[model samples]
Structures are given as C-alpha cells and as structure tokens.
Target: MYNSVSEKDWVEAAHPVSQNVRSDIAGAGCDKPYFEPLIPEERPDIDSPYFVYFGRIHEDKGCKTLIEYFKHFKQKSSNKVKLVLIGKNFMNEVDTSDDIIYTGFISDQKKSFYLQNSIGLIIPSPYESLSMVTLEAMIEGKPVLVNGYCDMLKKHIELSHAGYAYFNKEEFCDSLNKLFTMTEKEKAIMSKNGIAYIEANYNWKVIIDKYKYVIENITKP
Candidate 1:
C-alpha cells in the first residue's frame, strides 16, 4: 500500500516485485478534512510575523536546515520574520537567538492554534511517505513550505499551488522571502486552494471510497 501517488511511482520504479502486489494509494486524511465546517474561528495576530515548523526536531526532518535557512532569510529580508520550532529536540546543539522559538512537544490544541495563526507551515524533511502535518495545515487554510527533495511534498505544493518548495540553501532563502512578501490577498487565495485540494483528495471519506473500490475489485469472483 502507498500513502501518496509519488510513493506509488517510487515503488513501481525501485521494486519490480511491487507489480505483482495489489497496491493502491490512499493519502493520509486530515483531522478536519472538509471546509464546510470551517476552521474554528481564531483571530490571527498580524503583529506577530512567524512561520511554524512542527514534527520531530532532528536533522533528518531538516530542522537544522530550517534554522540555517531562516537565519539567512533574516539577514536578507527587512521584515522581522521569526521561526517557531514545535516538537521534541533530539539534537544537542542549540541557538540562543530570540528569533527562533522552540516549543518542545506541544498538545494538539496548541499545535492547531499555531497552525491556524502562523504565516505558514514549513516541512523541510528530505523524505516523507506522506506528511500529515502538511495536510493538517492545509485544513486550516495555511500555506506550506516544503523541501523540494521530497517528491510527495513537492507534488502537494505543485498540485495545490498552496506554497513553495526549495532544493538548496539559496532556493530555501528565496522561497522564504517570497512567502514573507506575499500580499494578504495572495495568501488567502493560496490558503483557499490548499483547503480545496485537501477536501477533494485527502479527506477521510474520499480515501475510504478509494480503498473500498480497490478492495471490491480485488474480491470480485
């Protein structure tokens, strides 16, 4: 089974035996997938200009890279953009800068609060089967910044036009600046696009329907 279309393609290319298996792609659904219910209304504080990064704070997840890129972004951009790091820190090294706020292992409620209000969400992981947090952010009509190396994440951004992706330090910094400078109208459009994408593709009802169809076909006599 695959969680994303990109992952399905990867398996088909990398493993010949995958052709024999009954495989299907069912993306991970978001906590609140539909837009009709709408996100719990919360006033986003305009005074605070910060992007949020949630997940395990480790090198593989690209936490270090995010910090470095943000540092560079701060140097280049005049806007006082901050980077809020959420999740447990496994690394020993730390920065004492006030610009980077580390909130280690927050509750789901707090996580949602941040996701709904932040400028955007960042997932710098080099690899991902399917980053559910990205979808969660989308549910809140929040744009995302993803690592270009992760094909699945990149595909999400491309299909939804919900955010940007970066491959290198230069690209990362450039994308950050672009996100920072985006107008309120532009951001709103991207956010709405993201929500629509999630509702159509990653909702639990849609995923279950796909799974049911696949199963019924396989079970047919």
Candidate 2:
C-alpha cells in the first residue's frame, strides 16, 4: 500500500508501467502507543495561547512562510498569542524570542505536552506524503491549519472538517485569528471532529486490519 494517493499516482505514471499492477493508498498510522495520555501534573510549564509546528524548521516544509505569517498576525492582532516550534532548527532563520519560541528538539512526551495544550497545529508544507505529524495532532484532538497547496493536507481538513487550509499569507493570518477567537463550544466541536476522524482513519487498529485484509487477498489461492 502507498502512503498517499499522490505516491500511488506517481507510481502508476512511470514509463512502462504495468496495467496488471494494483495499488492502494493508506495514511501512516498514529503512534498512539507512544503518546499515552498525560496527567495535568505531567504537562509542561510552557506559556499558554500558542500555535505549534512539529517538524524540521526547513524551507521546504514552509517554515519560513509560517514564521513570517505568524509574526505578521501577531503584529496586527491584539491577542498575546505565540508560536512554538518543536523541532530542530534547520533554517536558522527564527530569532527564538518569546513570540516565536523554538525548542531545538525535545522528547515525544514533551512534544505532546506542547501540542496538547496549543491553540492548534500548523502544517504549512507544500508537499507531504500523508503527513504523520498532522495525524498525530488530530489524534491528540487538536485542530490543524494546513497548506491548501498540499493535496494530502487539504484533503485531511476537507474529510475531517477539523481545521482550515490556507493558500496564502492573508488566509493564514485570517485562520489564526479565527482559531484564536473561536468559542469554547466551537473549539470543543472541532477537537471532537479531529479525534473522531483520526480514530476512524489513522488509528493503529484500523490500519492493522487494512493490512491484514490486503495480505489475505494477495495470498488467496
């Protein structure tokens, strides 16, 4: 099985492709076993009201765009929200101040600590093969703001209704504002929607069942 429909299509488009070959796409499963639910005391002492990015601070991942837009959003918006990045700094562009904090690389438990309490997850990558980080965020019941240019990310938001997908800086900033202003009930609904989507689509049990079915079919006499 392929990790994404895009990968499946690309494989099919290769020169001298065989029509006899069949392909199916499945998203990467969440690491729910590693991310055990945290008690309040176990949570980190990080400041509140922040959005998080959970991958490399590289240009290809759209880190530059996310950082620029977030700073822009902060400049105009009165709310004292922040942007927390929880990955290795590859780009070296971030100033690493309170408004845009960068925690080089941290443990999974600490990553969960930040993600579980953040305003939402932001994935601005223009390319992704079914982003595992996005699935992780959703499984944690947090809404996501993803790049609309990435088909996989956009499809996740579309299928799940758990967040927004922005194509440009204006939309990105606007989504940040919207997420910040949402009422508790609205936020809860979005959170619930994300959790339900992840459980139905990317849960390990469901993914394992899919693999079993595929294996059984291929092994049939």
Report the Cα RMSD per candidate. 3.8, 2.8
Candidate 1 collision pairs = none
Q: CA lDDT of 134 in candidate 2?
A: 86
Compose the digit string of candidate 1's lDDT tens values, residues 132-217.
Answer: 89998888898899999999999999989999999998898888788888898998899899999999888888889988888778
Give the winner by lDDT. 2
Error of 1 at 64 (Å): 1.1
Going through the candidates in the order shown, the clash numbers are: 0, 0
Stretches of candidate 1 exceeding 4 Å from the true structure: 16-23, 33-47
Tell me the whole-model lDDT of each prediction, alpha carbons only: 0.83, 0.84
lDDT of 2 by residue, 123-198 (tens): 9999997888888888878899999999878888998999999998899999998999999999989989998988
